[model samples]
Target: MANDTGKTTIDLGNLKAGGFIKERGKDLFTVRLRVPGGRMTVPRLKKIADVAEKFGGEFVHLSVRQSIELININFKDFDAVVAELGEGEQKVASCGARVRVPTACGGCEYNPNGLVDTQRSALEVDEKLFGTPTGHHKFKVGFAGCPFDCPKSATNDVGFQGAIWPELNKDECISCGLCAKSCAEGAITLGADGKPEFHPDACIYCGDCVKVCPTEAWKAAKKGYTVRIGGKWGRHPLVGTLFATFLPEDRVVDFITEVLAWYKEKADGAGRIRIGDIIIKEGTESLLDRLRAGFPDFVVAETIPPQAIATQVGK
Candidate 1:
């Protein structure tokens, strides 16, 4: 039903269901479109442009999470634009205490520095978990192909970064120091024995040493995701600390689902409280204990606390 002004009165339910945010003008709303992994074909982009020209102000805004927004849309044209989007295989994005659209780096597809296929990982997570309600506050997930962290995964609710622990083959060591020079974090150094030694605790798993190795000395011993949890970006930003490492890609969706379910169970009555705030209220150790009991199969790795990460970045 339309109001006397001919604009649809959007309630909270409709806002969450339709992915439309009421604009300053009561007669207009902004529609959000999901672009998973920030990957889109040219034809889809052109179709969005056409729709925006017809309904919006002939322009679309790109959001920080890689979604597209068509602003200045009148309520009268909402159905038409939604129909056009469906024809193009584009779906409206969601908000309001739910799993938001997943963001990701370019991944190994084109980025020479990437360690894993982040786009594929992101799409898999989006398919399995996007729009699942948290019932307390918004939850965000992001993927970075490597420690370069183009998407700033560390600041999201849950973040995943590609990693590969390199193992040195001493027999093939030429002592050229290429790996040491390539390592931006100074995790690799030449030992008194003239062979290269690696400090696993200091490594960011960027795979720079593997790429620069002339001989087959540095090899990937393990490759997987470095997981971070209880992070957020808002009026008060908190960088998530490392929770696990070498987490296999196949188990990522399950891990995320279980984590969200746990959060819902714990924060059911806590209105508008973020997961990070919960961690602060009850120490991280307590949460980690519960998480460990829930998923014993997940391999835990050494973690870098938020303070250490900040100190390293400052240098």
Candidate 2:
């Protein structure tokens, strides 16, 4: 129903229950539980299975936001289910105009290609931003361990990708060429002198060269987060624009808070409003100016579209 400002209000009880309103069921609801970073301990897993078997219809559905949903829970069993989940210390995930559970790929924890601790970042974001109010629409955040963007961070409201800029030491180079071979972006190539040459503009800073360098010729010059803002996926998907890079992990929380504050300040509506729209309407440079003003340490990426062709040479 609409509230005082004509904004639609979601039910507080349903939100707390992580309840999904069912259209065709004996009970009106199904519950969703948050599992940040999409990873859970064995004990918690077992507890969830047992709880589902006891109260739900013994079926669990996994959500895109890294949450687990127990279906076929009757209204009468709601209290019991909530108590069981509480006892297990599992938080319920809500779906509305708030920060949802963050999603992340397996970062440096185990993935060979990982450049940063994505799981740890996810947990940190969850602790700091989960369920925080957004002014007009829902906000989603995702973290990718590297440029692979496995978690589809490109399509989230706030996307953080792990990166490392590598520096080469010509003296230490054995010139094995492994770094060139490992680089998928063609950012690194062995020159005639048998030393690796780097193309900074083409490099996504995935850190492959650093990992593959046998002589430690390619060293990590800068390791940090690349921020992408104003992206979302749905009927009309808009890929987020790259906002900043080389953002130290320690400063990510502050960056996110400022971005959210800016969004809330600019967005005004009862219906869904996205940061991408704000960027488009006000010009990306406007947002960039504010970001630069607030966080002077960050290096914002310059986005320039390809120049137009003079003529269609081939049809």
Candidate 3:
């Protein structure tokens, strides 16, 4: 192909296998379709697959963010293709800047944490931060079912994980150390007079020890989650810093919504960088400052883990 000046066109045909990506509009730019939490009902998938076969390639590509990227779109036909997606009540937005996909647990069977249903919270987060903004770079968040880390929460721009408060029954403990055996992290141990000793630091907050206790000694702890931020898992993975544990389960959506708004205000255009990058350039203090600005009243600090080792012994 030649331009008006008769210059040869730059062909990226080699980059694609099936063939050069098809072009729809006057010019070429990649189009990213957001799918919150990597979820799509069967009907939703069917419609998108049809688009892929018609406008794009035969199938859409899955993304790490749980989003779908449909390439080779022409601006002219983009609207029609999107409309055909047929995701009832499904909303559309730019997947850049403040605009990005929201993520959540894809339904975990053993979620001991406070989080019950994540779909609603995921929607709220998207509504709050799904567009381009002056502040920091692209931010990413992960929602987890439990401490097992299905989506790798600790490495996101913001992370929310389920937690349980403890309910101890002194009368039932037989000093058998069954809880000690149950604790994979050795967070529990037998105390004097058949009671149990708790060492929160030793506890990873996993609740394994509590679950295995025969007498129902350790019931589900008060429900809640830990909010972590400024982390990334890439070439240089950074473990996010914990902002708070035990945020009321119901208010988490609002809390995160506020956090995104605050993040935007803090960076202005400069903050529009990734969480890991921001942490390096301005330091956690600056990020925290922006977070604090959003909610001056809320205190965000890491909560201590559980105390006591598992009961590996018997009465």
In candidate 1, where is summed lDDT lowest over 10 consecutive residues? 301-310
lDDT of 1 by residue, 96-196 (tens): 88888899999998899899988998889888898888889899999999998999888888899999989999999899999999899989999998889
Instruction: Write out the backbone clash pairs for model 1.
Output: none
Clashes of each: 0, 0, 50
- Please report the candidate that would top lDDT against the real structure: 1
The lDDT values for all models are: 0.82, 0.80, 0.61
**Candidate 1 stretches greater than 4 Å from native:** 1-18, 294-315
lDDT of 2 by residue, 1-315 (tens): 455898555435635523354636765466788888999888888888888998887579898778889888766666667677764477777677788788999888789988988898888888888888786788888889999889988788888999999999999999889999999999998899988899998999999899988899899989888888878876557778788888888887788888888888778653578777777776777778778877777747465211122244474
Off by over 4 Å in 2: 1-23, 304-315
Where does model 3 exceed 4 Å of error? 1-30, 87-93, 109-116, 132-134, 174-176, 192-195, 233-237, 269-272, 275-315
For candidate 2, list the clashing residue pairs, or say none. none
At residue 207, candidate 1 shows an lDDT of 93
Q: Model 2 misses residue 314 by how many Å?
A: 22
